[model samples]
Target chain A: MSTSQDFPTRKSSWKRFDVTVLYVFDLLGTFAFAVSGAIAAVRKKMDLYGILVLATVTAVGGGTIRDVLVGRVPPFIFRDITYFFVSITAGLLVFFFHKYVERRFKLLLIMDAIGLGTFTVIGISVGLKFDIGYFGAVFLGVMTATAGGMMRDVLQGEVPLVLQREIYASACIAGGLIFVCLDILNIVPDINVFISAAAVIAIRMISITKNWNLPKPKI
Target chain B: MSTSQDFPTRKSSWKRFDVTVLYVFDLLGTFAFAVSGAIAAVRKKMDLYGILVLATVTAVGGGTIRDVLVGRVPPFIFRDITYFFVSITAGLLVFFFHKYVERRFKLLLIMDAIGLGTFTVIGISVGLKFDIGYFGAVFLGVMTATAGGMMRDVLQGEVPLVLQREIYASACIAGGLIFVCLDILNIVPDINVFISAAAVIAIRMISITKNWNLPKPKI
Candidate 1:
């Protein structure tokens, strides 16, 4: 569906584009992530500000953790205001549309898969930018895509799904390899982003649909 | 008051006059911090394992953040398993005694103040051990004391009380200064710890009691 079709009649529909769709995917990911955070907040019966805090962490905590681990100073969300804007916007939407959003949790999960793929690729890109080893890049991608959710779960008092679930982090690792392979093929950078992201999203969605999982330890 | 009177009885609660209380105090702070985290987790309606995550973050997050900022490798909590052991024990207590604990919200705040004081000093000490300067030391100190709570609040979807209240952070700063002053005075290190910890605990307790506040921004 076209971006315009997604919004139906909203004026901001003009912001829609194929390239921006990548960003929209990211934004949708941010929104769903923030909603998960918001749902945790609601469970906590937090005030509006508290909800926003949870929303912000759910939106950015993984990236922030990844940055700190890579020894980046002050992390991007702290350095650039754009991330803050995205988080706040997402948080407000969650605050207003929580009921409707919760009813569509399954659809949001699919959108989350897309966002996860995009982030996994971004993580690999960042690792390469930092001259990290391939192993390090894979680790960074896995951490970047999932740590925020882990952090959100931890803060909300849940065991991180990534810790126990065999497929969640493994898929990010798979996508990171796809990114590495594409990079080795000398693909155009923009197409690389699209291909890697689509790969991750596909892998994740298929795995979930088919109940495909990495072998679990019998213990 | 005897350690038994004000704090929970841990293994071998009494011995070694000077350092024992401080270690116990650290444990006390850890317990209170972990409890607060667990309460927030419960508020979020998380499962059993989730409570442990919240508890651990609440207990160690502030110090871990401070360590990263100061370029410390391997956060102190992870380097020593003592913290995890203590945190989990505290979490179990919270899980079991949540009802009774909730009734003593005000008392818990007092314990939290003591925690703020002790952990701030501990963070500063950790920074100085790395040969960090006074500015960096104090900064880490405050971060060590408050960041975990902030993370807890953010994850639970609440505006961090630390940011909202002046005394919350101010107490850590004041305690950091006290640690510095005693260090400069060439006072015995053990005496310094006692005095500095007392200074923070007293100040925080007073601030909360009086509802002390920083002036609001004129803008």
Candidate 2:
């Protein structure tokens, strides 16, 4: 139920541009994540309510966990109703348009990577604000990027991509390390976040293109 | 690292008795849940670190989630560290003595029920303190009782048992409603907690004995 006026298109400062770009990525990622979760519920033959619940959790679960761990309770998603609306809307769209959406799985994957990158940056920034140390910041970033999808997959009775055969969490970790290094070099916070997000996105895209994966442990 | 003298046995008021009993149940549940988690990790052939992580999460995930939702972050587990130690100890014990532990699944189930009841009471009490209202209290109670097991199941690559079978969350809800009813009838807080916890335990035990379960969707 957002009005067109809610779009802040006129703010064109370098800092403001970075904020808008990240916000757009966040929204896109949330929407894609919700769609994937909804699709998952559909496959599981869950009811409408289940679809909504899955979608909402997949969209916000990672950030919620990150916030909770860092003691930022009554999480940001609770304060900002838009995330809820976005998730619900995405679920509904998927429910009504499954055939069309199902074919776009590849596109959804790309969007999920973008969301991962953006969430990683956001989580690390929050961790830095709490002064939880460099390692803690990176851990939080990885949590924010992957925990939601992990929960979604678990709820759907599947191994999480990050835990199985994917470079998802590693991308977040790499991005987080870059963010820390940039901060140490006195980079502006906004620009640091932008570069980190870009790094995550690039790494994720390359991994997908190359079919990169973490080595499975020998049992 | 607990001393036997840390167990208070001198105070014998009804409230004191309730506290001690619940404390015992809490520890029992934590230990049992950790063992169950360790067992699951073992079944999955998780590494030692994975076993410890799974055990710790299964013991504390539910309560941590409840605390976070109720704005009680920097969760008690983080502050106490005992929960961490308890989970780790349980995991190590299971790793070393799994064959002996494997045959004790029945005992573990009984302890899990007790832990569920205790955690449910603790969550509702915290919710009440936050003025989250009757419904919020009940919701938190259920979350605290079930979220750990759900996380454990998810991490083990399965759909959460609470969402699928038995009277697990339903029992929590029933007990929470009883807690509120008792509050309305002016029952003492400690007594309310004790009675509510007993109700949850009873319901869970009966459900298992009778093979009771919520209806699955026909679709």
Candidate 3:
């Protein structure tokens, strides 16, 4: 529920650093997500166009939905063509070098965790800009972190992994809750973003390493 | 691309009729789509909450996406809670009377066709209200008509029927094209809506009866 007026009036170098770091992480996440999507498409034996489409959707789908919900027209990717190009580059790289990429699956998972964390914070920040309440902001944050992969799974003809069994969305939700609490405490915005994102990354990485899972219902 | 200026200045009774008919059909489509979604969820052995969620998503997902694409805030369903009620009603009915409903599958198909046509024209009309080009308008039209079903299928862990083997989206595309052409001819808005929607319904009905399908790629 914090607004722009809640923050300190003075601008600081830390703010600039926060912006740069967020932007870098966003792009990194986009690339990692796109590569994962492209690899899935390749496994499905999709054509080049299908691979690109899946890559782009996986990389930017969640943010696009987030933007639209906030009444931002043209979405972020449409405004910044860089995301599109980055997804395309990732798709192409995976298409040509998928064997090497698959061999480095652990690296991909690490990058994905980073992406998830960054996207969660980004979505929360964007949602806070609007009049949507804290719950909506947190929901958008989890959605931004997981919706792209959910979509990628759906497109590949499977139930979304987050829905089936994963600690993935839980990490985003936990991070989002932390972000809201920090903001309510009037923590510095730059510090808040970094801390919240790091929390998400840490949780996701630990879950992955431990092979933690959400309990499944008996049929 | 036709704007408000291109339409006749006279506010005829036909205009009122058009508005009423369009609104009614829109609700009809929402209800039918929701029922379809609920049935799918039931088949998947999902619980009541899952059925409701699927029903609401299938009913409103397409229009929500369309509204977002056109920069409309809160989406049409949020602004008019009638759609939400309609979807919920449909879901509950399906949950209770699925056996009877399944027996009338032909009737469901007919209702679905009506929904597809109504949604297509509505989406195009909304798009034209904005500055997006004709192509974008038509694209939105198809997305509005089909995206819900696509999402429903994806959530059920299946490739979308439209992408796989149906002649569904093609019918919407054809209807959208017809709407644009008729609009360009400066036809009366009321007549244009009717003709375009009828065209979609007719194409869909014929395709169903004739067992028409889009070509599938050989793996």
On TM-score, the leading prediction is 3
DockQ, all candidates in order: 0.06, 0.18, 0.17
Model 3, native contacts kept: 0.28
Error of 2 at B68 (Å): 3.8
Give the runs in model 2 whose Cα sits over 4 Å from its true position.
A1-39, A45-56, A59-72, A76-150, A157-219, B1-13, B71-73
- Cα lDDT tens digits, model 1, B1-219, are 012221222223232465567777887888889999999998899888989999999988987777675555466775667778888987887788889888999888888888888887777766666555665567667778878888888778765675444577777778888889888997665676678888999998888789787433121
Off by over 4 Å in 3: A1-13, B1-56, B76-150, B158-219
- Compare candidates 1 and 2 on DockQ and give the better one: 2
Error of 2 at A59 (Å): 5.7
lDDT of 3 at B100: 80
Superposition TM-score, candidate 3 onto the true structure: 0.61
Highest DockQ among the candidates is held by which one? 2
Indicate the residue-level lDDT of B150 in model 1.
80
Which 10 consecutive residues of model 2 chain B have the lowest summed lDDT?
B1-10
Clashing pairs for model 3 are: none
Query: Which candidate would rank higher by lDDT, 2 or 3?
Result: 3
**Candidate 3's C-alpha lDDT?**
0.80
Which portions of model 1 miss their true places by more than 4 Å? A1-24, A44-50, B1-145, B149-219
**Number of the top lDDT candidate:** 3
Q: Best to worst by lDDT, what's the order?
A: 3, 2, 1
Native-to-model Cα distance after best TM-score fit, residue B49 in candidate 3, in Å: 11
